[model samples]
Target: MARKIPFFIQIILIPLLIAAILLVELKHPFPKFRLAALVLVFALIVDVAILARGKTRNLMVVLASLVFGLSLAEGAAGAITPRSVVKIDRGWSVRQPIMGWGPEKAGTYHAQMIDPSDNSIIYETNYTFDSDLLRHTVSADSGPAIVFFGDSFTFGDGVKNEETLPQDFADLTGGKQHVLNLALTGYSPQQFLHEMETSRFDKVIGPDPKLFVFLTAAWHAERTSCKAYWTAHAPLYALEDGRVVFKGDCNEGASLWWREWLGNSALYSYLIEPWRHKVKHNDVELYVSVLEAAVKMAKEKYGAPTIIPYLRMPKEYLQGTGFTNDSIMQRLSDSGAIVIDASLQKEEAAGAQISIRIDGHPTPYANRVRAAQIKAAIDEKLPGVLLADAK
Candidate 1:
């Protein structure tokens, strides 16, 4: 005798699951994901109308097997998986009229990094932003403005308010150059290009910049390619007739369901994430084009040399990942970028520890090392600016 399907499990529970999936699709609709979601919903509907009426016992067996299997898998994975609870200061970002998300607000926030192993707080500091949404530079803005651009490494993610690269550079040079830090956390080179393309360039920066510095990372390849999930709302670019052109934001037709669903899952993070990261969207050619375009524009518009700190090849990236792209450094150099050696030597790395324990982000001492190298690059690449500042 076949057992009847339970009203609660099939009629209520399965429908609820379908509803949740539909909601996610509505929120972040990707074409492929929507088709798959619709197919899954159809299967659930079939089970309710057809399978539930006839093969009740078999359906029950399958449901029970999936539930039991997933429970054991999730539990086993959770035991070994690194997890941490985060309490962030809200209202840090303001939504742009376009798809982009803007800067951190001008306020102080209690920021801390936690050890996932023992749930201990590694360090706590206040992150303070200025009226322009930049981290407060250690020195006042007065001299010829030297602008720094990149992600959090340039923004000093886990360091003190005054321990950033721009601040360290200002202090290293006796505050001769007025530092303008325009880097935001989770930003890519795309944002830098976007800034150069828009009117926000003149509005955000007062007067002409003395120089432009970009801290490129290996992970930035994924960021500019729109492979990183955090870049879903970031500006997107494409090459047209060997010129970089703005397309749209990353959320347009982006397939981010895995990141939305299983990103935090240890099993998924360890297994599937690597598989997906193997192939990039448009690859580094597009990346270099965007960079080259920004460089050309900066030279054409502001007559300032764009300095790209050579970071891809010499050592493992700040996040402990190696860049497999061979021509990344050479390409930038060929594109007329001032690529400098920012990688720390063994003795310097020993004294300065390349990364913090919380994540593989650069330490304060490491920033100072890079800043010193950058200042040297500035002296060599933009000697005119150096002479002007010295005058």
Candidate 2:
């Protein structure tokens, strides 16, 4: 007769076995690492069970263990896109386009090549804006300054430098202003605040003429807490002695956080993005939170009244889309900043022209329209400032 095990031993071992399998299945702590740990625990549990039963199925246990381990190994690697298949250059943001899942030539821009088969961004740019950060510095003689801040839309992805909104805004103001596009791609409100704190625009553009125009999008109001952008990358600038310092290397804190949070989870790179992008707009509070913070910051720091220009999708794109512009308008009204509702233009001939492309970024035509809208809004909101500068 086989020896009976204590009830306590059975309870302990069985639960551990179950936990190991469940952890492996749930892909905890980067999946593959959990699987390896699970396999070892499971093998030990099976061995103890076999010995307790005095069974001759030891050969079967060994075979099962081998099969399980092999399956785990294959799953780990196969679940992710091969790094070799992707060729992202180490400095550009993912917003800059890649050609066929690879880096484009120096001048040409392409969007992230998401694999249609799996919806994974097989390749992404490193989002290093060292050069752009450098360009933010201006001479005292560089004339009046306006700092432009936002996300990919503000960064001018599909358009050239001259055709971008900031450039057009600069031109519209007739060389009276030097607009700095401090808007990094993929920057949410929290990151934008961090950029503001670190970049020390106060030091760069001192006193009153330093206006800040925050061209925020409707989507980013819900994205303020996306710390993931800073986790894997080095900071473009570090705040030192109330001035910006170019660190020229990744921060240790950021690197460690990414390694700990992300680890080798293939699902993180393979699945999370498409899942995240498709998430519907439901959190109105989060959007409000970001808007309030932006308004507070603008009121306190810059003292220059904030101007928010309404962004509109091409009319054709809005058809059949289950979206309501009312909430956005409401949010803008509540923010207490000047809102330029350029979307409600009755005559296409009345406002400046914009891009006809449904999905592509704002065209040069759109930039001019946006600039004109800003001009009108500024005149209405801050009576003396804009018009006085215009004269």
Candidate 3:
């Protein structure tokens, strides 16, 4: 019989090989590393059976058991996470290669809103997307309007149609100001430019809007560089020669198998998306470029005054997120767009009045507060735009 390999070698060599394989898998772009890991695991098993003996064998067995237990614990945690429980099919989104995903269908869906703080306090509500794939409007269709463009905050994720920022703005003006909400959920500045280029506003709401309001949040910069999952399939653009150039749909060059696989994996999303954000190229330039394009479009197409209301986050959160209060304000000002200072929302958020307890979205009260600030800014800037058709 062959002499068994020493226990120390079995424990040290096997674990080192496994660790090396994992490190390579994590750092390398090749998919074959997974196969290598599997092969290494199998080889480790066979080697242990043949070579490990007594105390060494016992240690290897304990290590393997611990790894198995941790994996089970991880899977269980992922299974019961808040994200898993709130998987209602709202049917509000359609897959668009240009925008990655967009509001294509119109319907009201009874949805469950999960509070990120505590998932147990769930709220069931009706969410509606109009025929134009924008948030349902409350104000009447007549009179000059202010066009609102943004993502979920502007789309009113956890609030009713009447409680959205745009709707609240309309209400503050006492129905004299028509607010055309062109905002869509998960939208970025890139999509805003696309909407302008396609003349979606003209086709959906008639002549260009009197004023353009671009609501921006800190996450918009990170989202602009996201190319995995839904964003991987959406249309991508880049700034070329100081102009925005369409780079076509991401799915055209991406692997369908990889795309579909990663899109459905919660593990991949939970682990990889954040990692990508930290390691990927800085997206601030892309975001600023898109904003510049949008400002130019608003000026040239409709000669409308573009207002950028940057919904501020906590100061600590803004520090390393590629967006500073000063940098964003300066950029928009340089683009000839008026910038709304972050002071109002900053105070509201600090006082815990700007967001809901569970859902983390702007509450009705928060929207009302924000709308009031926006109206004040408009009144200060344009003087009589909000009071144009007052009774």
List the lowest-lDDT window of 10 residues for candidate 3.
Answer: 29-38
Query: What are the runs in model 1 whose C-alpha is more than 4 Å off?
Result: 1-51, 55-79, 85-87, 93-99, 253-267, 279-282, 313-326, 348-351, 387-391
Tens-digit lDDT string for candidate 1 (246-340):
98887644345544555544456556666655434356667777888878877888777888885654333322332343466776777777887
Worst 10-residue lDDT window for candidate 1 reads: 314-323
Encode model 3's per-residue lDDT on 299-382: one tens digit a residue: 898778888887655566456556676787798889999888633655664775667665677788878877887888887887
lDDT of 2 at 119: 62
Identify the candidate with maximal TM-score: 1
Can you rank all candidates by TM-score, best first? 1, 3, 2
Measured against the true structure, the TM-scores of the candidates, in listed sequence, are 0.79, 0.55, 0.74
| Residue 322 lDDT in candidate 3 | 63
Query: Model 1, residue 391: displacement in angstroms?
Result: 8.6
Tens-place lDDT digits, model 2, residues 62-120: 66677576546546655555543333345344322111011222333333435555666
